[model samples]
Target: MTTQNRNVEIEERHVEKKTDSSMVASTFIKYTAYIIIFFGALYFLVRYVFPMF
Candidate 1:
C-alpha cells in the first residue's frame, strides 16, 4: 500500500513538471510571436512608409 501511494505521488509530481514545462513553452512561443510581429511591422514601416516622406 505504501509503495502504491509512493508511485502515485511520483506520478503526480511528474505530471506537474510536464504541465509546467508545457506552460513555459507556450508562453515562450506567444512572446516570440509577438516580438517577431512587432519587429516585422517596424521593418516594413522603416523600409517603405518612412522612405515615402
Candidate 2:
C-alpha cells in the first residue's frame, strides 16, 4: 500500500511539472506575439508614414 501511494504521489508531481511548463510556454508565446506586433507597427510607420511627410 505504501508503494502504491508513493507511485501516486510521483505521478501527481509529474503532472504538476507538466502544467507548470505549459503555463510558462503559453506566457512566453503571448509575450512573443505582443513584441512582434509592436515591432511590426513600428516598422510600418517608419517605412510608410515617415516618408509621406
Candidate 3:
C-alpha cells in the first residue's frame, strides 16, 4: 500500500547537522586581531604622520 511505502521512506530518512563557522572562537580571535592592527596603524598615522605637516 502507499501508506506502507511512505512509512518505509520516512523511516530511512537521514538528519544532517549544520554548524556556524563564522561565530567560532578562531574567527572571533582573527577579527579581533585585525581590528587591533587597524587601530594601531591609524594611531601611528595620526600621532606621527600628521604632525609632520
Candidate 4:
C-alpha cells in the first residue's frame, strides 16, 4: 500500500511538472515578441538618431 501511494504521488508530481513547463513555454512565447520589438526599436534609434550628431 505504501508503494502504491508513492506511485500516485509521483504521478501527481509529474503532472504538476508538465503544467509548470507549459507555463514557462507560454511566458517565453509572450515575451519573445516584446523582446523583438524592443530590440527593433533600439536598432531604429541607433540607425537614425545617432547619425544626426
Per-residue alpha-carbon lDDT of candidate 3 for residues 13-44, written as tens digits (9 for 90 to 100): 68898778766878999999999999999999
Model 2: weakest 10-residue lDDT segment is 9-18
User: What tens digits encode model 4's per-residue C-alpha lDDT throughout 3-53?
Assistant: 443433444444443358888889999999999999999999999999999
Point out the higher-scoring one by lDDT: 1 or 4: 1
Clash pairs (backbone) in predicted model 3: none
Separate clash counts for every candidate? 0, 0, 0, 0
Error of 2 at 20 (Å): 0.4
lDDT of 4: 0.83
**Which pairs of residues have clashing backbones in candidate 4?**
none
- Tens-digit lDDT track of model 2 for 1-53: 35443433343443443358888999999999999999999999999999999
Whole-model Cα lDDT of every candidate shown, in order = 0.85, 0.85, 0.87, 0.83
Worst 10 contiguous positions by lDDT, candidate 1: 9-18
lDDT of 2: 0.85
After superposition on all CA atoms, how large is the RMSD of candidate 4? Answer: 9.0
Give the Å shift of residue 9 in candidate 3: 3.2
- lDDT string for model 1 (1-53, tens) is 35443433343443443358888999999999999999999999999999999
